[model samples]
Target: MPVPWPSGSICEAGVEQGIASKSRLVDVVLDESIGRSTPDVEHERAVAIFDLIEENRFCPVGDEGGGPYRLRLSLAESRLVFQVSREDGAAVVTHILSLTPFRRIVKDYFLICESYYQAIRSATPSQIEAIDMGRRGLHNEGSQTLMDRLAGKVEVDFDTARRLFTLICVLHWRG
Candidate 1:
């Protein structure tokens, strides 16, 4: 569920509704306040953000006039924050979502990823493939969950959801 947008926000539109491909995010930022990440996590974050910006369909539910928007993602007060703004630095809206729903899946995905990484060094090709398959399955499942959670709020395609899910997991990463 979405928390109310901050007061004095520039949301002339009513409560979030509708999905349109009229807007796309041109920038994605992670909170600097968040702790540092491992090299692997950093690489994942970079790749995810690059892919998301390269091609994505992200239209904030009620924002009109379309985007070229900028998204600043952060975790604060135990919630996930999506601070969206115009290219010229105008506030569009901020969406704060609960992190409880994603905890279990994120944990499981991390476990599988660790297993896959470990297997890469000594396991046979088939064994590595098996671990990779499981990791991808978990990643896909988490992405679907993210899409469901963002439904009616943010319009994003499956590939976009996958990349966003990676970023979300990155927020939880303690490395």
Candidate 2:
């Protein structure tokens, strides 16, 4: 028999003790504290949020929180804050990660991204592809780092971590 969920709780498949069935973020909001972003940054943010909402796997580790979740990403006091909440607007978990670990990778990723964007304008196809490859590599590294940092705090797939990393970069841009 299916377990009865409390009012405003979301129930998914396989809702056993520590497992929350497949989950995704239904709404993602960037904190206004980051200030306005450039058009390029804004576009990237939009795409990441869209892709994450369209497909993702996220569950709070060791918590009975259900999905879909509402997430707010922001930088506060030099830390990256992931404010997660239930669909009904009740808070679930708030994970504040240190930015020090991400500093170098994020810096490199931005540098490569700048090069990639510039390459798109004047570089040869081969050159552009090379820069793009580097950009992707850095992106992947950042995502992996994120997953590692979130380990035991929250559980997410690689693709979901990648998208979240992008948003983190966006936040880092202004910080």
Report the lDDT tens digits of candidate 1 across residue range 89-144: 79988988888888999999999999999999999999999999999999999988
Across 31-93, the per-residue lDDT of candidate 2 in tens digits comes to: 886668788878877887898787777777655556778998887888888999988889989
The runs of at least 3 residues in candidate 2 whose Cα sits more than 4 Å from the true structure, single-residue gaps closed, are 1-22
lDDT of each: 0.78, 0.78
The all-Cα superposition gives candidate 1 an RMSD in Å to the true structure of 7.2
Worst 10 residues of 1 by lDDT: 12-21
lDDT of 1 at 140: 94
